[model samples]
Target chain A: MANEKRVISVIVMNESSVLARITSMFAARGYNIESLTVAPIPDSDMSHITIATNGSSKVMEQITKQLHKLIPVYKVIEHEEMVEKEMVLAKFPIAENLADISVLASAYNGGVVNVGKEMIIVMAADEPKRVKHFIEAAQRYNPCEIIRGGVVAIER
Target chain B: MQMSGAQMVCEAIIAEGVKTVFGYPGGAIMHVYDEIYKQDGFEHILNRHEQAAVHAADGYARATGEVGVAMVTSGPGFTNAVTGLATAYMDSIPLVVISGQVPLSLIGTDGFQEIDAVGISRPCTKHNFLVRSIEELPRILKEAFYLARTGRPGPVLVDIPKDITVETGEFKYPESVNIPSYKPTYKGNKKQIVKAVEAIKNAKKPLLYIGGGAVLSDAYKLIREMAEKTKIPVVETLMARGVMGHDHPQLLGMLGMHGNYASNMAMSETDLIISLGARFDDRVTGKLSEFAKYADIIHVDIDPANIAKLVDVQYPIVGDVKQVLEEMLPLLEGVDPDRYQAWREILKRYDELHPQSYIDSDEVIKPQWAIERLGELVGEDAIITSDVGQHQMWAAQHYPFDRPRQWINSGGLGTMGFGFPAAIGAKKAHPEKTVINITGDGSILMNMQELVTAAEYDIPVINVILNNHFLGMVRQWQTFFYEKRYSETDLTFQPNWKALAEACGGIGYDVTTKEEFDAALKDAIKQNKVCFMNVSVNRFENVLPMVPAGGALFNMMLPSPELADSALEDKKGTK
Candidate 1:
């Protein structure tokens, strides 16, 4: 079977060790996690976890099933028709072309978030695939550093 | 009412209806031990080692179908119990292990006897918790018990810091657990049951592949009913022993590595395999691609993760085995047993042609014969626990077990020291029944200290050591696959087992002849004290009918050349 990139969202009880319980399971089972994001849901004692991974469909099925077996996991969604977003922060030297960088950031639904004496940091929030593209496109400005946040997904 | 967290722990245990606990106490858990001393409802067995305590609790759970409980202290204490936890986890035995942790303030300061108990046990335990405060004690205890016994049934650990154990808290044990995220599917899909029934009715060579889940679910009766009703042959995994009587016509005996020829052959030839609560473990499914190749599988398990995890199934039912069988049984009423009559005859023929046997000798005792004799003497009601080795296989093959929980062993983890401690636990569970630990010479020494625990507790469990003077299982493998290099396999430099038992305040018998063994066993039973019968047997004995590690089930290495030739002919004839 061919490896395919997939996104899975898990709703779990907000507990001190719930994240450890999940991430360890992925590690123990040899499942690759490309990116992972966890945050508490609003007005609830449960947390939402989104994991981006690449694996065969068979392995993905097993992973989903194994995730459900965790005591704190409330629900697992291997999104089919869903909206996903990733955030990336890129720092560039102040000497770089500001107009070109702003235009590139705008194209990826982003803008200049901060401007410091030696560096300019541009933040981009877009579809995870497009975020990757935006990172590649901004490399022309001699970026100092790049910090990419994990994928956060929701169902359509 | 305000109570110490220790008091609440005791109260919670009482509310959970746990009558017995196995544990070893230390500094961090001293408060709980103090409470345990003051408690009136439950009895605690003080084990010599934390690992043995966990195994004993696991043995109790496996025998009684109740959530076994064990308590240990921090750091080394918790580390010692990890093997037992993993053993129960692999076999899906329900267990609640309580471990002490350093005070909250000292948790990361490398306090005396402190360890990351929860973090270390995460992969092994079904679930684990680190008690943050005394207030969460009651709920966490309740949840620990609930999670351990429910769903697929596995070991759950609760790491309690010393400060929390000392702090005051309001105790209110919940009437029921309501973990919104942890609901297990108990009722299988109705549509899948109908499909399974259709498959059962159409299959001319159906085999019931039963595993530890069937034993855990307490579904032996239902499994037997389904097999007998459908006239399908049953093949039990190591953990599923006694789900069907050894003498039952439909039982082809245990399948997999050390399985009988008939069972392995039937597994290979079956047209339909109705796997009940079985995970189709690699041991049972030698060479996954070739396993049950001709069969359309209908798997029923409570854990959805187990279904089709390895091999794709034609029909899958996710639920408790008993419930799924209950749903499938009624639909199976009209099925004719005559449909599989021919298939049963073929398996029966295979069984007769290559029956599990060993050469009889007057001077030297055969391990298989010794087990058979033990079975005859102990009767069918005896609860037999075994450590992993050649002895375990012999016991499983020769013992006449006719009920669930009668045969207890570490099937999934294959822990060497499991037998004696487990036997102690089994005996504790049912003091009236004859409990025996059938262990090999090498395996017995691993936890022989438990003999003292048995003596101290006055729990009369017989430890029958099949002394072959070698780590027999590993030696057998070396003999076949490694040209008998025998590196570290020879165990000739061993202590006197008989004297060791006697020194531990237990009766000891060193028997070489068959008559001596019989007499010693009878006398040991009459003594009603912890007894260890060191029976010397032929040293070269090997567990036959093995499908060498990754080999196909049909390609078994039988004991004799004639049997192998016939098996080859049989395979050719089938083709």
Candidate 2:
């Protein structure tokens, strides 16, 4: 089978070593995790984890099955229809094209979030594919630092 | 009732009906040991090493079908137990190991005798926990046992800090546990079971491929019934030995890397493979792309992940092996008993044409003859454990095992030093039953210190050393594949086995001929002490019927090239 992009959502019990358990499983099996996000569910002891990766469907099936085998993991879903987003923060020199960077951020459902004497920081949250496009477009502004948050997803 | 955390640990073990625990105490776990010192509900056997302690527990679990328990202290103690944990984990043995940790306050401060045990054991264990507070200790303990024995069982570790054992709290052991995320499917899907039954009914040459899961689930009776009623030939993996009696008319012997000619040929040519509890490990399914190419597989296992983890399945049933077989047995009532008669006859011919045999010499002992003689002398009920090597393979191929749990060894992990310690564990579990450890010189030396532990505990398990004075398995490989570059496989400088056994307060005999070995074995079995019989065998003997690594099962390197060539010719003629 050909390698294809996949996003998986895992619901697990919130515990001290649960994240380590999940990530260590990936590392031990040599399964590549492109991006991963974990946070506790509101008003509950469970946590939701989102992971993105590219692999053959066969490997993806194995990964999903292995995730379910962990004690803390409650549910694993390989999303067919879901809302996925990634956030990125970029710092560009104040003397550079700030207007162009701001416009680009606005196109990606983001805008300038911080302004400093020497640099301006812009934030963007959009679909993972669009986030990639926005990062590429903003590179022309000579961003000093770029921080990309892991992708988080929810079923539509 | 209020009590110290140490008391709670003891209370939990007592409530769980644990009769014995294997452990080695140290600074962090001294509190629990003190509590144990005061209690009389369960006996604690102190092992000389933490690794042996865990292996003993594993052996106890495998022999008795109960969750074995072990305890160790922090840092080096926990690290030493890792290999044992991995060995049990690989075989899916149910175990609960309690390790002492530095107090919670000093957890991340790099406290003395502290290491990241939970982190180290994560990959190896089925699940693990680091106890943080006194309040959650009882629940975690309850869950650890529950997880260890239920579903597809495996070893679970609970790392309790020193402070938790010192702190006092109201201890109420939960009568039961409810873990929503950890629920295992016990009943296979009805639709899939029906599909499997239909496949069995249609297949002209069906094979019942059994593995360790069948033994774990105690499903041998149901499997035998299904096979007899359907008249399908059965073949077992190494771990599944004794599921079908060695003398069963439909048995095709073991199927794998060193599997017999008939079993391997059956696997290659079968039209349908009804795999029960056996995973398609690399050793079993060599050259995966070519494995069972003509067969449609029906896999039934308790673990869903193991269903299609390797070979794709046409019918996948996820549930307990016994329960699934119970459901599958009645559906097999309509199967024609004579449907696979031709296939069975063909396989039986293969078995006869190239039976596992060795040239018996009165001058020197053949390892195969030694195992066969031991099997006969020990009777049908003796529990045999083996270390990994040519001896292990010889034992598996030659021993006449008639029941499940009769044969125990480290199959998945292939740990070398597992035999003696495991034999101690098994003997402890069943004091009246005879237990023996068949080990090679190199494998026995890995954990030979456990001889003292066995003597200390007064568990008299006979140890038979196939002393070739060389790493026989690797040397055989070098001879075949590496052009006889011996490397570090030779171990010419060896200690006298008799002196070492006597030093450990056990009896020992050095035998070179078959008659001497027979007499020593008889004397050893008669005595009430641990005995080591070091039998010197032909140094150049090789385990025959080997399928070279990454080769097809049908293509085997047999005892002689002429035999292998004829087998190849027969396969071609059949096609």
What is candidate 2's TM-score against the reference?
0.97
Candidate 2's DockQ: 0.92
Question: Which digits, one per residue and each the tens of the lDDT, describe model 1 over residues A30-71?
Answer: 999999999999999999999999999999999999999988
lDDT (0 to 1) per candidate: 0.90, 0.92
Collision count of model 1: 0
- What DockQ, between 0 and 1, does each candidate earn? 0.92, 0.92
Backbone clash count, each prediction separately: 0, 0
Question: Candidate 2: lDDT of B9?
Answer: 92
The reply for model 1, stretches above 4 Å from the true place, is B561-575
Candidate 2: pairs in clash: none
| Poorest stretch of ten by lDDT in candidate 2 chain B | B561-570
Native contacts recovered, each model: 0.96, 0.96
